[model samples]
Target: MIRKLYDVIVVGAGSMGMSAGYELARRGFKTLLIDAFDPPHPLGSHHGEPRLIRHAYGGGAAYVKMALRADKRWLELEEATGEKLLERSGVLNIADPDVYSYEGRFEDAAVHGVSIESLDAQQIHERWSGVRLPDHFRAMYEPNAGYLYSEKCVAAYKKVALQAGATLLTHTFVTNIKPEKSYVTVSTKDDEFMAAKVILSAGAWFKTLEPFVHLPIRAVRKVVGWFEPSGKSFDAGAFPGFTFGNASGGYYGFPSIGGAGVKIGRHDTGVEWRPGEELEPFGTYPEDEDDLRRVLESFLPGAAGKLLRSAVCKYEFTPDDNFIIDTHPEFSSVLLAGGFSGHGFKFSSVVGEMLADQVELGKWGQDVGLFSARRFAQEDN
Candidate 1:
């Protein structure tokens, strides 16, 4: 019968939306954040026990700016929360010296001005014992790389957001949107509301939600495991996190802390999938765990002991495997933050600032040309 209005109504109260809502409300904007489920749900990305945060991104030089900014924000959040959400455990990329450490690897870091170190197999083994490199594989190590606690981070953000006076409506689904010249209409199951602006950060659902706007984002299912290694197999300090690529494995993992075991997953081989279909069956697929185990068997036999727990989450993928973080061309007031390509969690805080900036100053001060939906202009209606 009536409408509730806000300066900005953010759809999907997950990583991106919650981050945006926190920043917006902190900046004194009237904001509302809505989601179909609770924060840090395994239904979308930013799940599993942890997500990797590496400034030396494998995507390309285009992300150098975003990655660096994200690093700063992560530090800022750490200060804000006083919770140990990020670990500076560092990240290692293990592959044959000739391949993964090629133009893309070294050049991306150089272009982004991020620091890196190349290590021989022996160096990796001696430096980090939990690490198991193949016979001839070398490594490119990024010191700033680390891991993030996905669920805890979301909890931190949600708490900060509510403290800052933002309205967060969980278990609420936004069914549709109607954008007008001066304002936008947002419809949930129980109510209709008007918003001066809208940030469409529905993650996996972004592709279908904005078909009329034409985005290149697609949703893919990713499975990861929290594995309990043999208690005596390796010590925590010896187990530096690593991502391996070769004829054998393309998996990444962490060391056991407080008997948490080594958490591992293969990133490149997620199943083709959609959103919202009883995520349990899709969440813990039999084949996906097997797919990751194959990596453990090849690379780290003693460490990949048994799967203690596992989860399936969806990644919003773009054609270039980068991210799309800008306002929609058709609806300037409607910003889109999707297509994280399975590597968007670490950037959530910075992306929050970017979305907030777009809704405020009109630019995030970072050159995100490569991430613009305009790059997919053929599909960019």
Candidate 2:
């Protein structure tokens, strides 16, 4: 059968792919977005209700610019869609001073002129009565940092992309990708499609495309839990989204939103997940609940009331947890973006724009050298 031709084909129409599809379609490209399941589905990464967005990035100073840019684009999307996507309830990064250093974060904030407030453990407890921090822990609060409604963000992107004439194929699984000299062809279970440029934003399923783009990405299963808070202190009005760092890793949580209770998760604990394997049902991992309970008991004891519910998600990690956004080394027509590590959902807005720019202009506006796939190649040397 003759395949349909599009200007750009976006695989995995989740957070990053949907945004890129919107940008490409808005630019008048005949864009086609394909996904195994409908987006906003629990099977993918961007499913859980809220994801934190912060300007004072814990990842590194180099990411501050992208984070800020993503924040701006999110606002633009909100205005365009007329949907409340971002909630500026602020964010707190607390860490034991000896284990986690905030010096680089402070320098990044100062250099970028982003607003950040430093607070001691006493100050933190005084400001939010529900929190119990030891004297040795330090905190940095970014008033602009907050949470984004994950499902709503994806829906808004999809709405805008559909309005802009992007074709979406839900429940369609991609079987293979073939990159030619000037164009790329994508094979789905039902049919084949060709595009001038193809983007593989396949999230946890990225390993399926490993032969085309050899990036060391591993899919790991992680869990998040919602708990009933004892008092109103954990509400959005009083408490902010927070992260607590330690020698092992960190635990992050969001205030109770829409009566969903305080949602918490550990950033460091995830087991390697093989693709095509059955994913465990939600609330099946009792150990995850125990770990989260331990974190809440240590930091915000009042927030750990009852184990309301839990869900599992996947994070694709690179050797270095930074994202991989670059053209294929051999086939320029094929672009790849994955390895978001666990903190990529917030930047989906800007990442989409960058992917679209890569396809349309042959370059992106921002200095994306930090996320370049070539870095891994250089590291191998």
Winning candidate number (lDDT): 2
Candidate 2: worst-modelled 10 consecutive residues by lDDT: 279-288
Error of 2 at 132 (Å): 0.6
lDDT of 1 by residue, 344-371 (tens): 8888988899889888888876777767
Would you list the C-alpha lDDT of every candidate in the order shown? 0.78, 0.90
- The count of residue-pair clashes in candidate 2 stands at 0
lDDT of 2 by residue, 13-101 (tens): 99999999999999999999999899879998998889999988866766898889999999999999999999999999999989988
Superposed on all Cα atoms, the candidates' RMSDs to the truth, in angstroms, are: 2.4, 1.2
What's the lDDT for residue 127 in model 2? 94
Q: Give every collision pair in model 2.
A: none
Give me the runs in candidate 1 sitting further than 4 Å from their true place.
97-99, 108-113, 207-212, 231-235, 280-286, 379-381
Off by over 4 Å in 2: none
